[model samples]
Target: MTKQLPYSDAELAELIRNGDAEAFRSLFERFIRALVYFGVKLTGDQEESEDAASEAFQKLWQKREDMRGYPEMRAYLFSIVHNRSVNFVKRRSMVKAAHQTIQAEGETHSDSSITTRIIQAETMVAIHNAIDKLPLHHRDLLHKIYIEEQSTTDLAKMLGTTPAHIRTSKARALASLREILSDETLLRSCIVFFFLFSAK
Candidate 1:
């Protein structure tokens, strides 16, 4: 048997649309690794990137027949990855913010470092629970910058909104969080500590 030649991007697209499973497999083999790397660049987590890539492929396969034109297919596939990665980061950030909120409400744990870490972990969990209660948009904004670790410029580009809009959204979210927690002193400390730790 002769060794099979790799499909061109055009051939791959046509094959996929024609319900050729082998063509889809070949396309995945060709692009999955590079796509994963690109996803990680956007999401900063290998596991999340892998998941996003897998989901993108699944979506491509599912909608292959309806997909038109090679460029559009590629764009749609990547858009899935980008959106999934961003959403993943957003959820994680909301949880982190919530945990912080909870911890600040708790008493100091034992002075031992180990105990402190435990208490801090508990605090973080509590904070997450509180954030879980926030409105969807507020939680989403926090997740974009805090959990997903996206640069403001990149986030602005991704969201197709201005940096000032992002800043205002973040500000409004933080204000709402403070109101929810209803602890002025804790909110002040959170603001200070958040900036200090983030800068590092």
Candidate 2:
């Protein structure tokens, strides 16, 4: 396919409106990373962010015919993925109480939401740093189970252990994580950690 990389989102939308697959692909490539990153910030799960991005693009394709009146396709995509990310979190998270509490706080004080977002980035950093403080095996286990969302059976097989052991280790790792997040220095990140470690 010829390069459509130089086209603006609006131009791409125009081309897509006429059923141009290359134009749609171009827009997808252009915004996919940004959307995934945005989704990650919202949902705190890389896999879910990717799923959200995919869903957003699918919606974009279906809604291409209605693109003419929209001011910015990028913004339109962001809006869709943002909603998708929230729904993803709500559907999958075991920490719905914390999520709802944060949402309520955000609504109670509008600018507080923006402040919450800024803290979210910090919380991610804090979580990673706390994870690093764990033993090597625990760190790896936590990454596989939580970050990669691996099942206990699969993770146990990979580690040459029984699923029971994996579950026990996971519990220990989570206890350690809770301890680490409880530090006063990492106060902001605690809620994000809660939002993330849902019903696994």
Candidate 3:
């Protein structure tokens, strides 16, 4: 049987639109459990689902005037939580499947911070391979500048070249490395992966 919107629900919905806090509280108390259950069924994690439900209620408060009656209000809340759950799933999938694109090898670690986690071993290997593919002169230039931390002037003095030439070579080497490292899917996954962990 369909869940009918009671007259009391409709009355409270209108009251909330008029900025009545008591009525809003009544409505929240009435529907929060069902909303959380709805979210949990979709996300499979109670905490995340409840968080989504909370966000939905916050949105519904802001958008109270947009929806009318109990049915629209209930649907609106469910819609917001459902979209949140689906978008999160999509983001997780993108990162988790990063290796499928590179024909190579990767996590859901909550501590995946840049300051703490730094770069992964596989990412470092991929970067080293990309650098190795550069022209020998470009590779040596990158190594001296980045790995050895040589200033342009220092590099120039060692290589019997002007600092201006070393600067130009550094720019070219970085550009070449970027081209070699251009794996679109992997790059997208890394971005999503980083943000995902940071949110936790």
Give the top-scoring candidate (TM-score).
Answer: 3
lDDT of 3 at 104: 19
Q: What local distance difference test score does each model get?
A: 0.66, 0.67, 0.66
**Cα lDDT of model 3 by residue, 1-200, tens digit:** 12232344456567778776766665675456656665565557788878987998899899888877777887687667667866666566667777676421112224333212223322554576578678999998888888899998988999899999998988999998898787522542343334334433
Candidate 3, pairs of clashing residues: none
Over 13-121, each residue of candidate 2 has an lDDT whose tens digit, in order, gives 6767876776667667556766777678777899988988898789878888887732556667777777777676665653556545444221122456635653564
- Give per-residue CA lDDT, model 1, range 62-110, as digits (tens): 8998988566676676668767766776676667777554433222223
Q: Residue 125 of candidate 2: its Cα lDDT?
A: 56
Provide the clashing-pair count of each candidate structure: 7, 0, 0
lDDT of 2 at 167: 92
Give candidate 1 misplaced runs (Cα > 4 Å). 1-7, 99-200
